[model samples]
Target chain A: MGPSLSIAGLEVRDPRGRVLLSVPALDVPSGALVGVEGPSGAGKSTLLFALAGLVAARGHVRWGAQDILALGSERRAAFRRETIGMIFQDFLLFEELSAADNAALSALFHPRKARAGLRARARENLTRLGLSGTGARNVTSFSGGERQRVAIARAMASNAPVLLADEPTASLDRAAADRLIDDLVTFVRRTGTTLIAVSHDPRLIARMDRVLRITDGTVSGDTTPNTAEGAQ
Target chain B: MMAVWNALPALWQDIVVMLLLLAPSVVLGGVVLRGFAPWPLVRAILWRFRGASVLFVALIAISVGMGIGLLAQERGLRQGTAQAADKFDLVIAAPGSEITVMMASVFLQPSDMALLDGVTYNEIANAPNVAVAAPLAFGDSYGAAPVIGTTAAFASYLAEGHITGRMWATSSEALAGTLVPLDIGDSFTPAHGHGDGADAGAHGGAQLTITGRLAPTGTPWDRAILVPVETVWEVHGLANGHAPERGAQIGPPFDPAYFPGTPAVVVRSDALWANYALRSDFTRDRETMAFFPGAVLAQLYQVLGNIREIMSLLVLVTQMLVTAAVLLGLFILSRLFRRQIALLRALGAPARFVFAVVWSFGAALLLAGAVLGLGTGIGAASVLSRVVSARTDIVITAPLGWAELHFLAGFISVTLILSLVPAVMVLRQPVVPSLRS
Candidate 1:
């Protein structure tokens, strides 16, 4: 089962001491499909980064029983490896590696016995995502949409409980984006995985069970479209 | 273990030392990569920047090759020259430069010097414990080959009984060296001097027949032609070192009254103590000087050894500087892939894993270059040996030895240790900022 997240007094500041992101309180239940929406420079990506414990922030970000923000950098990386899978906007793939190898890159740091399974799963994920024969091709030769799908496959390869994606479909065409949204939602529902994605795409946001809208580094709206959970 | 090590041959001992010196790098690599296999990633990086990798490796190889080639060539030359003089145990000459006489007699390099007169030669020949005292007459040439005149006993002793045919039985019969370009029974007229300045017609019609050939000695003597000393004296209008009543006898037991002076005399004794005694007795005489050719060669080798040490130091320093520059280049190259490194970090890869990737990348290049440099050194040494042999007529063989392997081991260990610097610098970069960039 995916872990629930409980956060409080979360804030991120820039080098010049200006606030970049501030979240007073937030709660995400297990297996929730949530969307974060905001204009440019609205701290949407920063929030995703903080949730993954990738940036320095002050607060309690308790995923299940472990407070990730209170842990050291090494422990946080371990937490991310075991529990959180992240997808970035630009589809950061090693250009020199084949699509399958890039998808299974985490196998490099995994235990020796676990590496083969991870690689097999990565290839399976690529095949399921419409990249069957392309798994052996280098990512540098991939189109923008194909590269984005490879990044999605990589994020899901570990079967991590919590997945945080920032603009995952921004580089894909409308048809590819729709296909990706269907794949993500079906995988989340079947596996009871919590997926929190930050995107400005209306189609993506409308499919989420819960949505949070932020403006100027502060949350402005919170709603459950299928339920009666009120705004913040 | 100590006993076992001591029981091994010298070459084996050096091989063990070379392996021991490389152990630290190997152990460190194993520890650093304890749970990780960074080779795939390292291979990718190497292939990605193969141009830079090749450039760095070539730079290292050339420097190492030059250093090892020079050392091997120096050792080969020393050994070759020493081996050339091996037969000349002691040289007795007029009160003058021992080097000049040694060169004239042992190396067959002709030079003008005062000769040891009949009295000095008679004393040396009759000295107690003197097994063989052969006069050397060297002032003639046959083409580019020097024509030396000495007794049949000395010629037989120098060849170590490896002559292909019987020793010369008459003054007109000659023994050709292995490389003299003459066949048995072939005859040649002697020139009065060496090189282009030689008087080719000076000995008009005074021909000497080749009756024997010496086995290869891998020395300057390989190109010499040997005849009886009486032949040299008679051709120059001097007495044949015998009374007229003695007839045409060519062996020894010469009459001092009829002996013509010779440029140098090579002396030997069966007993080591007797050679020292002979040297002392010959040196005490005011008319002549005696010295061990081995001792003089040792003194020359000491000087050569000192120069080799200095050259080794300079090469070492230059290699270190080049390694440092290459490592710094590695740092800049690592920056080119900073984003990829940052991405790996964000994907929850441990810092040690990334460090291993970069460090192993650098270490692989160093090791490849070092191993390839060994071949380059051997090839370069072989080529240089041929050139030196061609120029000096001394067969020098500069095979790669334990010293070059030790040098390679030390280079690999030091550079592998230094490789950690770039890995650490890469780790110190901020992951989030790099990812963003």
Candidate 2:
């Protein structure tokens, strides 16, 4: 089962000491599909990165019983590998590698005995994500939507409980974006994996179970979709 | 195994040293790459920047090839010159510079110098344990080949009894060196000197016939024509080295009164100790000088050795500079892929795995360049050897040897170590910032 997230006093600062992201307190239920929306430079992506322990932040970030903020960089990386599956806005595929290899990149750091299983799962994910016959094709040749699907396949291949995506569908066209949204929603609903995505697309934000609005490095509003309790 | 190792030749010993030098890099690579298959990622990165990779490899290959090729060529020339002088055990010349006499006599590069008198010649020939003391009469030529006037015994000794046909039976009958473009029974008139200045008609009626050919000696002498010393004197209007009553007889037993002076006397003895004794006894006189050709050649090699050392240093510096530039280029190239690296890090790839990927990428290029450089070095050495042999008539052969291998091993190890700098630099990049960028 996906783990719940508990955050307290999570603050990220630039080198100049100005706060970039300051979340005083937030609690997220296990298997919840949450969305973060904000203006440009409002630290939406920074929040996602801090959630993944990819950036330095002073906070108590507990995913289940383990607090990732207390972990060293190496252990944080291991935490991300074993628990957090991340997707980037730009897709960030290794263009020279085949789609299958790109999706199975996590296998590079996994133990030898687990690598084949990881690769098999990556292939299965790629096939499930509409990349069945394109496993051996170089990702550079993939369309923007297809590339993001490969990215999704990579994230889903690991079977990590928590998926943190930063503008995952930002580069895709509307139709492609809708298809990706459908895929993400279906994957989340079926597997009950906790999904935290930062996006400005209203089509995507409308589908979220709850949304947090950030402005000027602080959350300005929090609301559940179509509910009176969300107004509070 | 120890006995077998001890029995191995010096070249093989050097090869073992070369392999030992490469062991650290191999061991380090094994440790860093343990259980990790970085090759696919490394291969992908190399393919992504194929142009830069190719350019870096080519740069390394050129530098390595030129360095080792020149070194091998230097050694080849040394060995060829040394081999050429192998037959001349001791050269007795008039009181003059030993370098000049050695060059003139052993290398056939004749120059104006005082000749040893018949009395000095007779003394050398009659010395105790003297096996053969043949006078070397120079300053004559046929076409581009030097005409050396010496005894049948000296010709046989130089050829190591590997003569193809019969030895000369008369003064006019000559033996050709292996590379001389003349056939047995061929005849040619003698010129008074070498090159274009040679008087082609100097000895108008002094034609000599080729009676036999000597096997290749890998020396300047390979292009020479050997005839009886008496014929050279007779053609020059000097008395043959015999009394009138000797009646056309050739070779030693020449009466001192009838013996014309010779530029040098090549002396051999049955015992090595006798040769040393002859050199010492002959060195005492102010009239003549006796020296070992090998010793004189060794002195020349010392000078060549110094030059080689300087060239080696220069090559090493140049290679290091090129490697440094390549490493810097690699660092910049890593910047090109910083986003991808950041992606990997974000995907939870360990920093060490990322380090291995970058390092292995650089190392693969270096190793490919080094291996290709070896082939290029050998090819360049062969071409240079042929050019030198053609011009100097010394059959130089620059075979790829342990020295070149040692250089390559050192190059590979140093560059592989330096390659780590780029990998570390890549690792130091801020992962979040890079991912954002």
Specify the highest-TM-score model's number.
Answer: 2
> Candidate 2 lDDT, tens digit per residue, B217-278?
88889999999999889899998999998849888878889988998999999999998999
lDDT (Cα, tens digit) per residue for candidate 2, span A153-206: 888777888989899889989999998888887776677789999998887887
DockQ of each: 0.66, 0.75
After superposing candidate 2 on the true structure, give the runs of residues whose Cα lies further than 4 Å from its correct spot.
Answer: A227-232, B1-16
Deviation from native of the Cα of residue B419 in model 1, angstroms: 0.9
True contacts kept of each: 0.62, 0.70
Q: Go through the candidates in order and give the clash count of each.
A: 0, 0
Worst 10 residues of 1 chain A by lDDT: A223-232
**Cα miss at B141, model 1 (Å)?**
2.2
